[model samples]
Target: MNITWNKRQLELRERFREVATDLVAVGSDARDRDASFDRELWKELAAADFWRLQVPTGAGGLGKDGWDWLAAMEGLSLGARDLGFLMSVASHSGLIRLLLTAGTPEQQHRWLPGLTSGEVAATGSTEESGGSDIRGLSTRAVPTADGGFVLNGAKAHITNAPVADVVMLAARTDTEPGAFELSLFVTRTDVDGVGSGPGEDLLGLRTSPTGPIAFRDVRVDADAVIGGVGEGLTRLYNTLAYDRILFGIIVGSSLEAQLEPLVRQLETRHAFGAPLSAQQYMQEKVVSLTMAVEGSRALAYRSFGQLEDQHDGYSLSASVTKLFASTGLVGSGLDLVQAFGHSGYESGSAVERNLRDSVAFKIAAGTDEMQKKNIFNHVRRAYRSGELAPGSRGSGT
Candidate 1:
């Protein structure tokens, strides 16, 4: 795939880089230590129109494509150096896309402005019982006499829950146990019976506040349903298709950022009267990391192309991209720590923070094991259906 950025896209990416460097760099250590989200930085992002890049022009957004959005995200990740803040932005972007894709006209009209203008949003799909398993969700949404629904359940580890203005809540609306029985609702967080749990102090991404959200008989009219009743799974999977690709970019870019500074340090720092970069072992490690970053970029952009083209294998491609990129990121982070040695391990060091942050990529979109399982299932199904050549099953796709 030819992944070329035009003049306009390049310009936008540079602009994002500058803004992120200026706004997100300050007090990063303090914010991470305090486990606080930077509301002021968020305002700066809003003023720069970072939040509306993916929203369509008709809905008062910038009408940029997926590639442009990914580029901007990469720029921000490169400059920000704060994984928590990037997580918040990525979550907000995902919710905006979901709204644009499935929200009714009135629903979009009501929420798109605020959402695109930097008002935070959260997704409440994972319950305490199940992390990413939609089948294990127990949240219930029973229809009321007034044609609305009364939602009752809890969502755990919800990003931006404490400050979100709106939440995309998924709950079981039917008795039968299956993916299709679920429905997606745009629930206002301020409504009665909706409560947020205390913020969690996480190992990484500490600047992004995450907590549980409770829904005790939360009521919403039928108009709150996104897409349609029993279509939550479909909409969710659709959103994941894009989200996984963006995540690949996020991890890849962050790794690239970490790799660059380490490389510079290795080139300048001397050990045994020789630059660290002159060491054969260190050179090999840096070369491997550089290759990984490039490979991840290729996979991410290729997956983006597949999605844009609506390829039959886009889902499989996206999963592979996420798997490859996230694993590469974690590996590269380890390489950075090794290259920097004791200095890298020091408290408040960028390399140390990156090592802590890179780990979350493996668990965020889906775990490494989960991605492998998805790849295996998809390939197995294809092979059984005679899609694979006689001896091509073990060969790389």
Candidate 2:
């Protein structure tokens, strides 16, 4: 199931593995204890340039090629038991990427270096009560006579809200409800009247900060508008393909990391005078796990390649890839729990962490149902256009 890594990718994986081992040791504690993100790991990863792995050299990152960056992230995610760490790093990239794509030169110069250096953390606010309905957002930023703007609204389920150095918030700037009037604003979290509090107590990824941020007459200069008004939704949705691709990569990586270790345990341990691996029942279970992991990796890698080639069909593939990776991987996780029995259920075991973390992936990039529904809608329209191809119809047909 493993893809061939180039020399450079191999080198990068080795480097990240060192950090991954350290993270695995403490990630479970942080997740289960409902602790805030671990500052120590954040500092070490930032110092190691791990935080800036994918950022452009123009912006002070390692400038790792697209494949290398995706590969390294998948590898690290497999071993990183800390969902919070993964979420924090991802939120950081989301903010940086949007700014780099949409920010003015002055804005990039002013903020990119700090983000790459980890001098400050970043987060995004796009999803809301309407469920990613950017056009329907209740949040607004209005013109002020002083030439600045007054912002008023709130964002829910924001990752890194408690410690974000900067946040890219999307707001409507015109009367059009469905067109792209949304503007992306890069605001300092400490702006007067801008505050996040009352963190939500969650069932999983509890280690990551998830809270509501309220903006009350928050003031900002014209410079606060990223890429200016009228371009926010464009950049925000543009980033989704890459983000969803990585989300798929991580799902494959995490489940495989947990499953293989348990397979070995079953291979050697005797059960009723025979190794569990020797029993037809256990053998069947192992085969199922193998298929799940391999299936996820195959779908993810294909999607990654499409992304690398800038293929036109990638957006649709990304939906399918993300949907399968998020859901199929969990079916494989059953092996870890069943093969190891009660030991797999222990809070200290990697299997336990995998079980807890797997549930969140569907919700992370997008829900499993959402992915299917979005792709189904695309397919439905494609069918009507006679572009879905002969026999290319989806099962919902």
Candidate 3:
């Protein structure tokens, strides 16, 4: 239950905050209006080694651990109000972790350097059928005689797909669709038959360009297979498990950023012949939001600690953290908007933008319903196995 950060973690947080401040200073609302991802800003982040934070030193990364990674992400989110930019960075980190964990040595050597250097990488698992249902994906990858594969499918709502250099694509290698039939391939976007659709007009995170990618007879060698044939589900699940926890911290940090502006407004803006902060209702709202932010941070840190400890229930813990933190973010965003009154509802306002950004968190990684289902299934299995005492009503191991 120790909640203290060491010197290194504190120093890293400060460094990330400084980088975020510099980036924010150069950022303009034009990026959001244009729905563009700033290549120059991404390069700045890369030069700062933000992309290398999760990578291993031997692989040309910063060699930081999970806690450090969370700290960096949280700090970056707190300093940079651009949720879309942060989302893009987080997605690249997830792809890197997948490659490092499941990729072959040759594959890692070929792709890790570029990915860690902030050359964008994307994951194409979500299809038009629905991202939540993996078993329903229709993307097919037929094996060729030349020890390669011809992929034909389209991925929807792919983050950073518009400008990604490499994509970790999921497709069905078997005739029948099921969990075991899926496989992952690292497909180069520059190859023939790889097409990207126009940028999507999303409600939020507009700066992080998103679009659909079509793979029409896209060819890749057998060496492109990640982990192995029929291992896509396993690899994907692992990636999401890690991503859910990390995203919790990101959302928590974003919530923290919203608090300061809110407090400033309350302290400076007079209402009913006094400052808003003097009102009991305003004070209550601030206290509630403060508690939510702190709770989210605690949950994220605890789940990460469980992961580092390799606890048996870490998967469930991650799901819980993601579910709570994302929903909490959405709630807190709404509260902040209400606290800001009319100014918050103005176009391009920070609170309005944050609300839009926070809503996406519920859908990304896994939806709120999906997390509930996962938690339910885990609890059911534990209870049925007598891991939980019949009347104890406790979360079983």
TM-score of each: 0.94, 0.87, 0.93
lDDT of 2 at 210: 71
Where does model 1 exceed 4 Å of error? Answer: 177-180, 390-397
Best by TM-score: 1
Tell me the tens digit of each residue's lDDT in model 2 across 179-276.
54777787888779888877677766767777777888899888888876777766665566666776766666666666667678888889789888
Q: Write the per-residue lDDT of candidate 3 for residues 1-397, one digit (tens) a residue.
A: 5556778888888888888978842564677767888887887888888777767777777788767767777778778878788778777777787877787778777888887665888888898889999988888888999999999999999999999998988888886533348888887899999999987899998988888999998889999889898888877887787778877777777777778888998999997899999999888878877776787778778777776666777788889988988878888888888989988898888788888878888998889999999999998988898777767665423
lDDT of 1 by residue, 1-397 (tens): 5677788778877888888788897788899888898777787798788877877787787888767777787788778878888888877877777877678767777888888666888887777887767778889899988999999999999889988888988888886644348888887899999999999878888888899999998889989888898898877776676777877777766677767687798899999999999999899878877777777778778877877777767788888888887778778788888888999898788878877877887887667777888899988999888779676554332
Worst 10 residues of 3 by lDDT: 388-397
In model 3, the runs with Cα more than 4 Å from the true position are 1-3, 175-180, 308-310, 390-397
The order by descending TM-score is 1, 3, 2
Quantify how close model 2 is to the true structure by its C-alpha RMSD in Å. 3.6
Error of 3 at 143 (Å): 2.4
- Please rank every candidate by lDDT, starting with the best: 3, 1, 2
Residue 154 error, candidate 3, Å = 0.8
Candidate 3 is scored at a TM of 0.93
